[model samples]
Target chain A: MRDQNRQFRLAKRPEGKPDHDTFDLVETDVPDPGPGEALVRTRYLSVDPYMRGRMSAGESYADPWEVGDPLRGGVVGEVVESNGAGFEAGDIVTGDLQWADYATAPGTALRAVDPDLGPVSTALGVLGMPGRTAYFGVREVAEPGPSDTFVVTGAAGAVGSVAGQIASLAGARVVGFAGSAEKVAFLEDELGFDAGIDYSATDDYGAALDEAAPDGVDAYFDNVGGPITDAVFDRLNVDARVAVCGQISLYNATERPTGPRKLPGLVSKRARVEGFLVGDFAPRFEAATERLAEWVASGDLQYRETVTEGLESAPDAFLGLFEGENVGKQLVRVSEPDE
Target chain B: MRDQNRQFRLAKRPEGKPDHDTFDLVETDVPDPGPGEALVRTRYLSVDPYMRGRMSAGESYADPWEVGDPLRGGVVGEVVESNGAGFEAGDIVTGDLQWADYATAPGTALRAVDPDLGPVSTALGVLGMPGRTAYFGVREVAEPGPSDTFVVTGAAGAVGSVAGQIASLAGARVVGFAGSAEKVAFLEDELGFDAGIDYSATDDYGAALDEAAPDGVDAYFDNVGGPITDAVFDRLNVDARVAVCGQISLYNATERPTGPRKLPGLVSKRARVEGFLVGDFAPRFEAATERLAEWVASGDLQYRETVTEGLESAPDAFLGLFEGENVGKQLVRVSEPDE
Candidate 1:
């Protein structure tokens, strides 16, 4: 066992885009598991866009991470030691944990990861929170019917990719907006999306949509909000549904960004725009996970990952999301799991 | 009966706010009723905000009124003659009719006005399109619960006044934004709204909302969208719902207006913003109108109207909606009902 554990702490709140100064890495003694707790050795650290909200002092769905406190996020780890907890040593688990090499968590908070389903790192990605988010968002919020045009922004990212594929599987014509030609190819070629637009390559998204989504957008899963959203609002068909999953583009803004008023357009279309959080569907998570696992195993739903080498790369990995650097799930490999 | 009917025709599409130049008063012979048609003498003509959309060449929910075509709107009138139609002569009815002293429409298009319900003018006011808009918007869309802070803009206008009253009746604590101190009193004293803010009297709407909706807004019904909507978006609580019924404030803008992007705030609040047209609920409008009539008959729902004297005043009555000159449903009393 390692004698010391390394953890990342919030150094300060970011004004706009976070920089290296926003995080502080510190070495500490390996945490001991308390009664009904297990010491976990983190193998893969998930660097998600939602974590950006925690870096700010403002109110959000998730509580803000205070400065000087250990940063926390989704982690796939192996149980190092169990102190009267249900799990045994060497068991793979996933839960919300500290951004550290070793940390302690209550047994009830952790779920065992099945390696046979896929790579255990998927416990932090495809078969996890992002997958559930996409599952519910497509089926429940933005319910794209057969022959409906489903348009998704940030289409090559973990959640957006999954969301687009899910909508396609539901028999909807899927159109995606990704950052690059390569990512757009992945969406159209690999994921069976009907069409893919490299949003970064075009200035007029409305014109692109005119060619790609000629029927107009019936169901929209928005991850990157800004000009893309404005363009989507313009093309919304009557009775259209928009699921607001994330606004990664506006997350780092120092001041509130303004755009053409959308509510007026909504009245003409009778469209519905709703924002949702995955945690709100906790009771249905297990069933959603099973369905997602089946899709992953059947090769029906494909995914990708941009894994950085060490825990030190976590902040850079996270910041890459806002820059559209990562193709899919962004993760930091802290250490290898014991056989 | 008048042999010559004076009708208002669209002269040309207005650049911004329509004026006398937008309408050309012309005299025409009263048309004879055809098969399944009835000739009706217009009594009260409804001058609504939505008409502005029809005046433009741009696409909207309603078809644009072409230049040189007679302007049409909701009108309550006394049937002069029937040709194989359901109504008898002198029977009061309401339907979309031209801005003339007399017009002919198919029997299927006209609904008999039960004079015993209230004043016949109400067929175009409280018991008409605006009232039904408020009904579905409040009961189905906004859906305020007991103790919920329900905020509404244009609270003294046609749809908004009824919306606040209905929400208040549903047990929500209602806060209203009106244009004048008298309108504020009308909302608070006569209508039973918990609080009312004279929006024209205050430069800071956020501060006004802070005082009126101290618990934060749970449900919002927006009628006059613009800066007031921006302020309401700022004070939304978790799980808020915004029903976009109208954007009268933006109807006159020559250019598409821009405001703070609201989708990001929606994510944190897990909120919903939906825009709707009353016509979308056509299948259920009868039931809704019946319920609204019951509320009115029971004195649970109170309504007021600002009536202009003649057909010549129709254009002025509609232009007044943009200026916030009318306290309630603005209408033009073309003539009195036949004895």
Candidate 2:
């Protein structure tokens, strides 16, 4: 194992879309686990679209990443050294940590992952934050009833993909809006989505949405916000529920983009729109994880991952999320775990 | 009583704002009530901002008024003649009826109003649709908790005045945004609002709102939608509730206006925004009326009305609502009932 740890730091705030200059990869002495801490060898580091928000000097869900600070995110790792109780060497764990080859964290922050629960990496994808986000957002926020038409933007993405499946399980007709034809096919053919619209190929989103949701959208799970969300708002049925999970489309915008006013329609339809975070559902995480695992075990839920091999590729992997290069969760594999 | 019924008919749809030409006052011979119907001599006719929507060719909460058809609205009248079982001549009743001195309605549509409920006109003001709208909107939709900083726009208007009072009664710190200093004084002095901002005098709404709500806005009742709403959205606390009762500010917009995007804030704060109509609370209207009456009886609730004296002034009264000419509920007193 390398004696030096390599990590990416926010070098500067980006005006819009971030590039290589936004990050600076630095090497340092491998961190040591202090009392009640564990030294983790990161096997996978999550590269999410939300990370883009932290790279800007603006208000976001999380505090902005200060220039010269190492970036942080969800990391699935194996404990190499420990000075804490309940955690031993070779234990596989997951927690929010630095995007580095190795990270040291409080043992309490790291939750042990059972490899037998179908691949430890699933802890960062379908069995983790993204999965729980989909579960709570769809089941609680959107509340799609049977025979309802559910439309989800960013449908081929981690949270959106899972959200669509949850809507389908609830006996609703699920429709998805994805960026590419391959992603659209993945949603319709592999995931049992009733219909999938390739937003990249469609000029008239309103017309495409009308064709997909002929009866009107009963629930909308919005993972991306822009013109697509505007169209969905226009097609909402009376009492329609909208769950605003993310606005990845605007994360990289230089300025706030205004669109058609939506409040008028909400009043006429008596509809509801809400925004939520996964951290808010921490108390119910165990329940959601159990259900998601069962779905995955029964082949009722499926997931895809786009991974780049090495800590050096983490920046590119994260930037690729904006370019629609990822179908599901984007992660960077720093090393292979011990079998 | 007059032998001919005079009513306003939709002459044509207005391009932007309806003018005198938009209405044609037509006269016809008064007809006798059929079996199970009552001939109601109109006393007070409601001319509200929502009536402006029916005159347009766009979709709204209610159906559009067709060309050459008499406009209909809430009318408090005396049963001049009854061919119905439950109603007697001279019975005071209120129902949705044509804007005329006299019109016939099914007895079932007319609800008998007690003259003892602090003036029967209170049925059209504090004891009526506007009152019930504020009741359900504050209690159910916004759900303001005690000690919450509640902010309401169009705060001196009919529904807003009541909504602010309801929030104050719920033990919240109420702040109001009104169009004039007199209206602001009405909210702060008579209605017990903690603070009132005359939006017309303020150039920076965000700064004004911040000064009023030093902590943050926990609940927002939006009766007017425009730049003022955009500013309140910026100061929303975590888990804030927004009740969108009306968008009177946008009722006469010639074109759809685009404002700053607000969905991104929802994800971080986990806020909820819902639109509602008073009709949605029909099942519990009796309970709301009782509570509202108790409040008014206790002198804890107060209201004001800008009454236009004749039925011929109904069009101008409604148009005045859009112009911010009326302070509270705008009603035309068509006639006085025989004591």
For model 2, the stretches where C-alpha displacement exceeds 4 angstroms are: none
How many Å off is the CA of B120 in candidate 1? 0.8
lDDT tens digits, residues A1-339, model 2?
A: 779899889999988889999989999989989899999999999888788888887778889899999999999999999997359999999999998988899989999998988888789999988999999999999999997999999999989999999999999999999999999999999999999999999889999988999999999999999999999999999999999999999888887789888887789999999999988889999999999999999999999888898999998998898888898888889999652
Worst 10 contiguous positions by lDDT, candidate 1 chain A: A330-339
Compute the lDDT for candidate 2: 0.91
| Deviation (Å) of A245 in candidate 2 | 0.5
Residues B84-130, candidate 1: write the lDDT tens digits.
78999989999999999999999999999999989999989899999
**Candidate 1: lDDT of B226?**
94
Question: How does chain A of candidate 1 score by TM-score against the true chain A?
Answer: 0.99
Candidate 1 stretches with Cα past 4 Å from truth are none
lDDT of each: 0.94, 0.91
Docking class of 1: high
Error of 1 at A5 (Å): 0.9
Model 2 CAPRI rating: high
